[model samples]
Target: MLDVAINHAVVIDTEKSVEKKINIGIKDGKVVLLTTDTLIATRVIEAKNLIASPGFIDVHGHVDGYAYSGELSACQGITTTVGGNCGLSPVDIADFFARQMRDGFVINQAELIGHSFSLRQAVGIADPYRQASPEEFAAMEQLTRTALQAGACGVSFGLDYSPGASFVEITALANVCAEFNRVMPIHTRLFTQNDLYSLFEVLAVAKRTGVRLLISHFVYQYGTGIMEEALQIIDQAIENGIDVKIDSGMYTDWTTFIGTATFDEQTIADNEMRFSDMVVASGKYLGKRLDRELYLKMRKHYPNESVICFMGNKAEIYTALKKSYAMPSTDIGTYKKGEGHPQIAGSFPKYFKEMVKERGDLSLIEAVTKATLLPAKTFGFAHKGVIKVGSDADITLFDFEHLKDNADFPDRGKPDAKPTGIEYVLVNGTLAVDQGGFTGEKAGRIIRV
Candidate 1:
């Protein structure tokens, strides 16, 4: 008998270019059968009007073992999240994975060993503006090797956070990642709003080091009147045999901790951003637009607090994601309930609603492919992003016509309010979300390259 069965669902086969009504049988955490015939199961999900796609994969996020963030991800139909992004992660990758495995989690996770912050700090370079000495660089390389051996999927960089990370240091670490055939995801070094050079610098690294590169938050980095040019550059790079792709969110505003160089007074001035354009996303001043006093206070007293910087073109968001190489991501940070960007709960839902149902910019099949198989192939997640007889049974079933994202920014509405129309989500053959509500199932596994 099957452990669970989903009946009368229109299943999307991302790899095979097919979407057909099929009955799915799950047994022992895998999809054992896909047929039109009837099957017996211990539990059955009636999904006649629902579209069954591989569970969405968030390619860029910071939900590195935070239970609330994982729950939010699961609620959004994201069965797998790639964390350790933007130059911050647990220093001990092995211990991080081990702990998550020992103490179960709601969704599957894969991690990147972070440069610019975690690796630099681990090698005793505390100053973000100081170049890594030769000895320190060697130590960081060794730590990266250790983490990769311990199951880290890739290496990530937040170059804007570390101004002193030399080109040599970056290439050397990227070379190590290339050696392991791991993808390198980068938050490029851009202090000014229109700095395409930062984008070029990353592309140049991929060109030279031969690392498969994933650009994190493409719209946030270049949506300020330069998105068209940025996409052209990426297109040219790919045309020239440089392996590259991008992940973007639906919003123009991006969030990060107040203490990072991204919010430094000089950096803000360089970007020509005003304090009013910033909003406090987390901490005591949640939902308040930044003024000089509040900004300085948070930077000094609550350096770890998250702030959302509004600085991109709204239309450019779709313009970026319309490209074949671009995929949607949350860029979600660890936040307490009711205090975070709406992306934490709304990204994937919003992606489907806007890109598919509302705007018709992407067909349902194309959107599903980008959200599922694209990231799976990018990160080498062989079994998690497809619907086949032998594939891992991670699936999301949703009603397209009824789907909508209700979560909004803290100032506008509840940031963590869940969306509607996600009927069921299964992670590793267990029902993680049932009947539009989370079931508190911790069936996700840690994926390592």
Candidate 2:
């Protein structure tokens, strides 16, 4: 008998961009059969009037085995998440993987060795504004090699978080990633909203080192009336034989800690961001805007407090994801239930609602492909992203009409509000979300490259 079977569903064919009514059989956490045969299984789900697709792979997230965020990701049909993004990750990818393997996360996690925050600190570089010394570079390079050999999927850089990370330091690590044929996911630094110069700096590493580059959170960086121009540069880079791809979230606003270099006085002034546009997203000051007094207090005492910066044009979100190489991602962080940005809970559902169902920016097949296969291919997860025979039994079933995002910002309502229409999600043939609620199962594995 099969482990599980779903009969009579509109199964998505991502490779061919088609949909067909088909029955699927699963066993041993793998897709075992894909035919019209009526098969018996230990458990069967009647997928009447439902659409079944390969589970989403969130290309940019910070889940890092944080249970609340992992559960939230599973609830949104994300069966796998690429974590340790934006230059913040566990210092030892091996230990992180070992711990997650012993204590499984809610969804499968693929990790990247982080540079700016995690590695720099590991090598005794305490100041974000001071460039890494030659000794620090040597130490970081050794750590990078160790992590990559231990199965990190890529190397990530949060340049804005470490504003002092020199291009030499960056390219040296990029060479390491290139040597191992791993990706470099970068959170490019910016001195201003129109800082196309920063984009070039990131591209220069990709161009020089011959490493594949995945620009982290594209819309957040360039959606401030310059997304079109930013995309043009990416297109040019791709045309010039640089392997470049990007992930964008559905919302225009983004969340991060108030203490990072991103929120410093000089950085804020350079980016032309206003205190009024910043709202406390988590902790005791939740929902409050930053005036001078609150900003100083938060910067001093509550530096790690999460804040939501409302920037960029909302239209820029749709525009960016409409591109061929663009994939939807959730810059999700570890947060308690109801105590983080809505992106943690709302990103994937919101992507489908806004991009596929409502806006028609992408057909259902195209949307599913972007969320699933494209990311899997980008990160080289062969078994995780497709709903074919021999692939992993990671799947999502949803109703189109009811698919939408219910999560709102802290000021508007609940920030971590769960979304609607996602009915069932499975990871490795185990139910993670059943009847739209999390099953509290620790069935997810730590994906090591």
Candidate 3:
């Protein structure tokens, strides 16, 4: 008998964009069959009147194996997440993977060895305002090589958080990532919300280095009414034969550590962002908007805490995601159950709701493809993001009609309210979330890319 099976389901064939009714059988953690013939299993799930698609893959996140973050991701029908994004991650990539592999997690994790924070900090570079010395740059390059050899998905840079990072440092690291053919996900620096020069710098890096570049959180960076122009640049780059991909989340607002260089007094003024525009998303100040006094206190005492910046043009979200190369991402960070940005719990469902069902901007097949197959192909996960025989048995079954995001801004309500209509999520043939809830299976594994 098969280990698990789902019967009477309309499987979403992402590659072909066809819905084929079949019974899928899983054994040994792989898709053993997809046929109409009778199949028996140790456990069978009745998927009648449901659509079975490859489980969603979050292409950009910062879950990093934190328990609450992992549970929240699984709850949204995500089976795999790429962590260590935005230049913050554990320094010991191998040990982190080993620990997660041995202990098991609720969702599969692929990681990028972060450059702006983890590696720089490891090499004793303490100030974000200072560029790395030649010796320090060489040391960082070596650490990146070690991490990539140890199975990290790629190298990630958060230039906005580390404004002092030089072009020399970036290109050197990009060359290393290119040498290994690993992805280079960058959160670009910004002098203003409309500054396109930052985007140009990254495009130049791709042109110069021949590395596959992933512009992380496209909407967050450019959704301030500049997405049209930003996308034009990306399109032109592609036209010029540069390999560039993008990922964006549902909401227009962005969240980040309150202490980053992006929040330096002068930097904040340069962006024209107001203190009132910031709302604490986590920690003791949760749900409070930042006034001058509160901002001062938070910056001084709780600088590491995260805050949501309400500074995006909502319409730009649709414009950005309409690009064929753009994929949905959560940008989720570590937070307690009740104390984080809504994206942690709401991103996928919200993406499906706004981009697909509500706006009609994307067809269902197209939406699922961006959330699934696109990232799998980007990261070279051969067995994932497909619903064929012999593919890894990772799938999502949702109630499309009822699927929506319930999580709201911290001030509006619970930012982490669980989403609706994710009925079942499978990882490696094991049910991780069943009937809109966690099943305590913890079937996740560390995926080496």
Candidate 4:
């Protein structure tokens, strides 16, 4: 008997961009059968009128080992998450995975060894504005290689947070990623709102190092009036034979720690961002808007607290993700129960609702492909993004007609509110979300690329 059988569902074949009514059988954490015939299983789900597809893979997130974040991700049909984004990750990649394996997690996690913050700090470079010494750069390179050898999926850089990270330091670590055939994801340095030069810098690195480059959170960086120009540049880079891809979320507003250089007074003034546009997403001042006094308090005492900045062109969000090389991402961070951005629970569902169902910007097949196979191919998770015989039995079943994201900003509504119409989610052949509620299944594995 099969371990689980999902019968009579409209299954999306991401590879072929087609949908068919099929019955799927799973056993030993792999898809064993796909057919019209009925099958017996230890547990069977009748899933008529629902759309079944390979589980969503989040290409950019900060949900490294946080259980609540994992729960929120699974609730939104994300079965595999690529964490250690934005240059922040555990120093010991192996230990992070080992701990997750020891004490099981809610979804599969593949990590990226971080450069700007984690690796730099690990090498004893304390100041973000100071260049790393030659010895420190060598040490970071060695640690990056060790992490990659120990199963890190890529190397990530948050250049804005580490303004002093020299291009030489970046290319050195990027070369190691290329040597190992791993991806290099960069959060570019946004010196100002109009910094197209930042994007070019990253493109230049990809051009020089010959490494596979993934730009983390494109919309957040260029969703201003410059999105058209940014997309044009990306298109040009791809045409020039540079392997470039980007990830974005549905919302125009973005969130990060208030203490980061991105939120510094000087950076804020340079970008012409209003203090009124920033809202506290976490910590004691959960929903309060940041004025001069409150902003200074948070920056000084609560530097690690997350703040949501509402900017960017809403139309540009759709425009960016409409690109063939663009994938949807959450940028989900570790947060307490009521303290975080709505993207944690809303991103994937919102991606479908806004891009496919409501706007008609993307067909259902195209939307599913971006959220599934595109990221899988980008990250090289060969077995996790397709629904076929012998593939990993990680799946999401949703009613597209009723799909909607209920989570809103902190001041607007419950930031972590669960979405609607996601019927069931499975991770490694184990039921994780049943009838829209999390089933407390720790079936997820640490995916070492």
lDDT of 1 by residue, 1-449 (tens): 89999999999989887899999999999999999987779999889999999999999999999999999999999999999999889879999999999999999999999998899999898889999999988999999999899989999999999999999999999999999999999999996999999998998899899999999999989999999999999999999999999999999899889999889989988888899988899988999999999988998999999998877789999999999999999998999989999899999999999999889999999999999999999999988779998899999999988998889988889989999998899999998999999999999999988
User: How do the predictions measure up, each by TM-score?
Assistant: 0.99, 0.99, 0.99, 0.99
Taking all chains together, the TM-score of candidate 1 against the true structure is: 0.99
lDDT of 3: 0.92
lDDT (tens digit, per residue) of candidate 3 on 1-449 = 89998998888999898888899999988998989986789988898877798999999999998988999999998999999998888888999999998888989999999999888899998899899999999999999999999999999999998888999999999999999999999999998888999999998998999999999999989999888899999999999999999999988899999988888898888999998888999999999999999988998999899999998889988899889999999999999879989999999999888888999999989999999999999998889999998899999998888998899999888988999989999999999988788887888889888
- Candidate 2 residue spans exceeding 4 A from truth: none
- Native-to-model Cα distance after best TM-score fit, residue 236 in candidate 4, in Å: 0.6
What stretches of model 4 exceed 4 Å from their correct place? none
Best by lDDT: 4
How many steric clashes between backbone atoms does each model show?
0, 0, 0, 0
Which lDDT tens digits does candidate 4 get at residues 211-302? 99999899999999999999999999999999999999988899999998888778999989898999999989999999999999999999
Worst lDDT 10-window in candidate 3: 434-443
